[model samples]
Target: MKQSEFIPLTLITGFLGSGKTTIIKNLLQREELSKTAVIINEFGEIGLDHHFIETSDEDLVELSTGCLCCVMRGDLQEAIARLLTKREGGWSFDRIILETTGMADPAPIIQSLVLDKISAPKVILDRVLVTVDSVTGLKSISEFEECSRQVAFADILLLTKTDLVESVEGSLEKELMHINNNAEIFKSDFGIIDLELVLGEYKRQTIAFTENEIDKHSHSHSHSHSDIMSVSLYFKKPIHAVALTLFLELLAEVLGSDLIRLKGFVYIKEAPETPAVVHGVQHIFHPIEWHQSWPYERKETQLVLIGRNISLPWVRAILETIEEEVEETTRQNEN
Candidate 1:
């Protein structure tokens, strides 16, 4: 199906008290976003965030199962499916927004969207918007691994509570950039932002880096926070399709939950003209998306793996070995 045919789902996440609910509440009041269906996942027994949103009860579904990143992934999928089913039954909604508990990791929740056969076909991951408290954002990133991961996976970083602070500290912005250079940062006063920026056309950013560059980037940003890190791999040579599958399988088997997020475009030997877009969280991956043509001037494989304790050298070595073996096998078959 065409990308536009799928219902876009935006994920809102942040550290506790970062004002995710405030943002959702404000956005829902907008004329353009009034038709949005919101799914609020709260950690404890009582789910108060949904009540605060003020949306119609039918449009708001609260999940009190557990932390979305841990136990309630299935429930999240089911909720989306239910919402989509309602849409089919004359309930009108163009988009879906899932607000995860502040303490949630977000990776597993993402995995559910990427891997679920049911919801994956109907809904597309529009963007990951993470809210960070301007006053306490730096401390949260330093103290909590969950906060760090939220920042790392974010497509847009919303710095909330800016009015309370005299000035948004440069250190907080610097720390956020250090963790995730790709995310676009914006100052959100009382959770209000231009709707166009939040619900805009999705653009996939390419993260290409050599091993040396990854090492340098890591060393420079090592002092900021948690053990979570990122490694980028750029391969000029087109990899065999079989080799790409093997490479991802090996990574999933080896890294498991430690592999937080992996996304990039691969130049496949079989179809050199079209790039295969890969997105994965831990062991689960979205089906490879084949773009009509390369989105870059240069066509090459550029993959960024974000995780904890992942070795760049090991990942590269595994890919090279798998590619070589696959190439040799193909050559013999031809002979």
Candidate 2:
């Protein structure tokens, strides 16, 4: 087996009191996260969150200097680079996780890694996990842009405090789906979630359209707030690779900031055995990865898009049109 050259870095971000630290505390106790270097940003002089995390001194690094998004960003980079140095000096760590301040927006922090020339090559961003306080989550999204943006950029969203709430289905849930349709929402009682779900490789599970169908997934809803909504598209047939690329390009050009995150596995006609994995943040998309084999016998293309101020009807129409165009061209060439 080929060992991965870069260390995987995960980001934990959410609004104030949204249980970001609570999730980290739970993750530290798991053996899966052991030998993981944790970098935490402290808002004040004392790093209270760090104290709560039970890890060795070598594995824990606290940035009590300043907020990671602002003046302390340089220090954050230095801390990560130092961790790399420690690894060379006989320290053993497989992964790194960073906890951001609740009020902070995650874009800048992500850019810090993407734009860094030196440290960028050493670490690969694995995933971003955002926690939402069920009690105050809706209120925070309504009142604060930071909270909304945090949700927008998340790969996985943990809805904490579900036990305290009378019902999980409400305006808050509707609003969350509107703002970020792409994130997989899981309910957590008190920061207790299976480590596998949190740290495992992302695999999209699709629901069948008909009861008799082998597999499928679907959701439809209307929200009072119109800024964000998740759009899910499932193709019963395999899609052409070029058509899929064009669709993503058009989306990035048109949606821009309105496009929060896009992720899903696609079955391509060109490669029947391997599924093309696609993911993008805003307009910037990461390179596609191809899985060796299908997760199951099902061979269909699936795409889930989370965007702001976009219509599902328009998205669906555009994609259908693109696939049609590709098929027509292929037919003409074959003739």
C-alpha TM-score for every candidate? 0.89, 0.80
Show model 1 residue runs off by greater than 4 Å. 2-5, 119-121, 208-216
- Which of the numbered candidates is closest to the native, going by highest TM-score? 1
Winning candidate number (lDDT): 1
Model 2: lDDT equals 0.77
lDDT, residue 211, model 2 = 26
lDDT of 1 at 232: 78
lDDT of every predicted structure (CA atoms): 0.85, 0.77
Q: Indicate the worst ten consecutive residues by lDDT in candidate 2.
A: 208-217
Candidate 1 similarity to native, TM-score? 0.89
lDDT of each residue in 20-74, candidate 1, tens digit only: 9999999999999988999999989987888788878999889986888889988
Please list the residue runs of candidate 2 whose C-alpha ends up more than 4 Å from where it truly belongs after superposition: 4-6, 30-32, 43-48, 54-56, 64-77, 108-122, 162-171, 199-226, 296-298, 324-335
State residue 146's C-alpha deviation in candidate 2, in Å.
2.0
Steric clash pairs (candidate 2): 178-228, 178-229, 181-230, 206-216, 207-216, 207-217, 208-215, 208-216, 227-309
